[model samples]
Target: MGDNNSAQYVGIDEVPSPRAVGINKVSLLPLVFLIFYEVSGGPFGVEDSVKAAGPLLALLGFLVFPFIWSVPEALITAEMGTMFPENGGYVVWVSSALGPYWGFQQGWMKWLSGVIDNALYPVLFLDYLKSGIPDLADGFPRIAAVLVLTAVLTYMNYRGMTIVGWVAVLLGVFSILPFVVMGLVSIPKLEPSRWMVVDLHDVDWNLYLNTLFWNLNYWDSISTLAGEVHNPKKTLPKALLYALIMVVLGYFLPLLAGTGAVPLQRDLWSDGYFSDIAKILGGVWLRWWVQAAAAMSNMGMFVAEMSSDSFQLLGMAERGMLPEFFAKRSRYGTPLVGILFSASGVLLLSWMSFQEIVAAENFLYCFGMILEFIAFIQLRMKHPAASRPYKIPLGTAGSILMCIPPTALICVVLALSSFKVFVVSMIAVIIGLVLQPCLKHIEKKRYMKFSTSSDLPDIDHITNEGTLLG
Candidate 1:
C-alpha cells in the first residue's frame, strides 16, 4: 500500500491553479454548522446512553469517547483533507495511500454506510412528530410521510451545497437553542449528585457504546465536501476545530442538565425522552420546543449526510473510479445522480426498526473506518514530506499510537454486533469487493464512459514500490 508507483498517479497540489470560477463555495460559519449537523445535530438520540448505562457513564462516554474516536478522526481529516482537498475525502486519502482498487472499496463502503445512516433521519423526524400527529404512527400515512419527507430533503440537497450549508446553520441554531434554554431552566432544579449515579454490572455495553458511537462519529464526512469549501486548506481545519468543541459540548451540557435536574427514571430515557425532561423542567411550551428542535435536527442531519454521500460518489467518479456520468453536476453544481441514488436508499431502508437501523449502519461504518485508519497511517509513513496545508502535530510513531485506541474501539463495536447485523454487513462488504472489478471490466469494454478530470495534477515523479498493506 505504501508503494511508490501509486504515488505517481495524482495529488491535489498538482491540480491547475484557479478552481472553477462560477461555483459558490461554502464559507467558514456555514461549513462549521454543516460539520455540526453531519456529526451531532443536538443530542436528540443521546438519551439512550443514559438508558443503557447510568448517568455517570453516559456523561463520561461523551466526554471520553471523543479522545478515543473523534479527536483522532478529526485530526486525520484536517491533515489529509488539506493534503488532498477534493470531494472524495477519505476515499481520496485511501486511494492515494493504498491503491485505486482499495479507494473504490472505501468509497463504496462509506457511501453505503452513509445511506443507511441517512435512512434513520426521516424515521426519526416522524417519530418526533407522531406524538403531535397520531396518523403518522403507522399504516399508509406513515409510509407516505417517509416518502414526502425524503422527497423534500432530497430536493433541498439537489438545490445546491451553499443552500444546504446555510440551511444547516439555521437548523443547527434552532436545534441547539432549546438545549441552551433547557440548561438555564434546569440550573434551578439541579441536583449535582444525579450526575454521579452508576452501576458497572447493570450496564448494557452494546447500547451504551452504540449510542455514543453513533453520536460522536462522522467527523470525516465533512471532508467529502472539502472541494466545495472556500479556501479549504485554511477553512477545513478551523471549521473542524470549532465544530468539535460545539459537538462535544452539545452532547455533554444537555446531558448534564437533563440528568442533574430530573429524577433518574432510567427506563423512561429512550429516544424522545428529552422532550419529557423539558416538560418537567419548564412546561408544555418547552416540551413542544424540544420536540420541534428534534424534528428540525433530523432534517439537518439528513441533508448534511446526503450531501456527503452524494458528493463522495461524484468525487469517486472524478478520480475515474466510477463511470463519467457519476461526475456530472447539475446546473446548481450538485451531484444529481448521487442524490437520487441516496434518496432512493433512504426510502427503501426506512421500514427498518430503529434499533435495527442503528446497529446495521454502525456495523457497515466500522468497516469503512478501518480502511480509513489504515490509509491515514500508511500515508504518514510513506509520504512524510508531502505538503499538508494542515499537519497534525504528531510524528509517525505518534500517529500510529493515536490510531491504536480508535482501532481497538472499532474492534469492540464490531464484536458487539448481533449475528444478523454481522451477516448483512459482510454481504455489503463482499458486494463492494466484487463491484470494483466489475466496474473496471465495464470501463475497459467501453460499456460506460470513464475519465479522470483534466484539472487534477499528475504525480509520476515519485517512485517507491511494495505490495499492498495487509
Candidate 2:
C-alpha cells in the first residue's frame, strides 16, 4: 500500500534543468469552481438535452445520470487523484497499474479530447455575443475574436493555476447568477406537468446522451492538475463534493425553469436557447444577463480545460514520455511549452463546427475514461491496501459492481457515436500509438532530453509493473 501522508513534490534535480519552483497551489474554493467549470460550466450548453430527448428525459438525465455516472467517476477520481497526487493525474495511476505505454495513451487521448472540447468555448462565447454584435457572426472578425480570446485565456493559464482557479470562481458565480434570477423569476409561470413531456419516438437519443454526457462527464479532468492543488488529499475530495452539488443545481434549476415556463419547442432548444428563455421569462435585461453569463462561462471552461490539458503534457514529460522541453515551466511555474502546444491544437482544431467537435471530443474522451476505469479497478484489486486518501467506501466486489453501470454507459456512448466521429477519433488514437514509439526513438537516440522525477510514488504491484518512467 502506498502511503497517503507523503507530500507531493517533483524531484526535478533528477528530472532536468528549468526546474519548477515556487509552485502556486490551488486551494479549496478555487478548486471547487475549477472542478465546477471542468464538469458543468453552468447549463449554457445543456439546452440540447431538452431539444434532443424532450424535457422529461433531459430533466431525468441531469437528475439520474449523476448517480450512475458522475458520482462513480468523481469517487474514483477523488480516490485515484489523491492516491497519485501529482500533476500527471490519471497518467500516473494508469502507468502504476497498467504500464507507461497505456499511461501515455491515456494522456494523449485525454489531452487531445480536452483541446478539441476547448475549441467550442471561444466560438460559443462569440455566438452568445454575436446577436448584440453581429459583426462577430463570421469572417475575419470571428476568426480574430477566436484568436484573441484563445490567446488571452491561454495567457491567463500561463500566469498560474491559482489565478485560473480564482477566475473560475468569479466566472462561475457570474454565470450561475443570471440563471438563479431566471429560475426565481420563472416560478410564477411554471407548469409542473410540462416537465413530464417526453417524445420517446421522436427523441434524438444520441444528441441527448452526448449533450448530457459532455456536460457532466469531465469530473476526472481536474485530476490532471492535482499537483498544483493545496493539501489535495483534503481539498480534492471536499471540492468535488461542493462542485458536484453546484454543477447539478447549476444544470437543473435553469433547465427546470426554462422548460416549465416556456412553451415546448424542440427545434428551438439549441445551444443559446437559454438566453432566449431568459428573454421570454423575464425581459431584455435578464436575457442580456444570461447571454453575458454564457459568454463568461465559456471563458471559464476554456481556461479550466486549457490548464488541465497543458499540465497533463508536463506530467507526461516528467514521466520521460515526452522531451524534457515539455516539462519546462514559466516563471509562474506553469507549463510553458505544454501551454503553447495545447493552445496551438486549440487554434488548429477550432475550425471544426460545434456539433462535430462535441461528437469527436466525446468519442475520444470516452476512450480515455475507459482506460481510467480499468486503471481504477485494477489498482483496487492489485493494491488492496494502497493508502488511498479518499477511498470509495466499497470492497473489491462492491467496487466492481459500482463501475458496471458507468462502464456500460461508456459503451453506449461509444456505440452511439456518428460514423464520422468514430472515424476521426480512431485516427487520433492511431496518431497517439505511433507518436509514443516515435518519442521513445527520439529519447533513445539522445535527440532530446528526457528524465523521470525520482520523487514520484512507487506502486509495487505483484505483477512487476514494468518501468513507467524512462
lDDT of each: 0.88, 0.86
User: What TM-score would every model get versus the actual structure?
Assistant: 0.94, 0.94
RMSD of 1: 4.4
For model 1, residues 106-205, the per-residue Cα lDDT tens digits are 8998899899999889878877778778898899999988899899999999999899999999999999999999999999899999999999999999
In the range 122-164, model 2's lDDT, one tens digit per residue, is 8789878887799998999999999999999999998988789
**Residue 350 lDDT (model 1):** 90
Candidate 1, pairs of clashing residues? 1-468, 1-469, 4-464, 14-457
How many angstroms is residue 65 displaced in model 2 relative to the true structure, after the best TM-score fit?
Answer: 0.7
lDDT of 1 at 447: 96
Q: Which ranges of candidate 1 are over 4 A from the true structure?
A: 1-19, 459-470
Q: Using lDDT as the measure, which candidate wins? A: 1
Query: Residue 416 error for model 1, in Å?
Result: 0.6
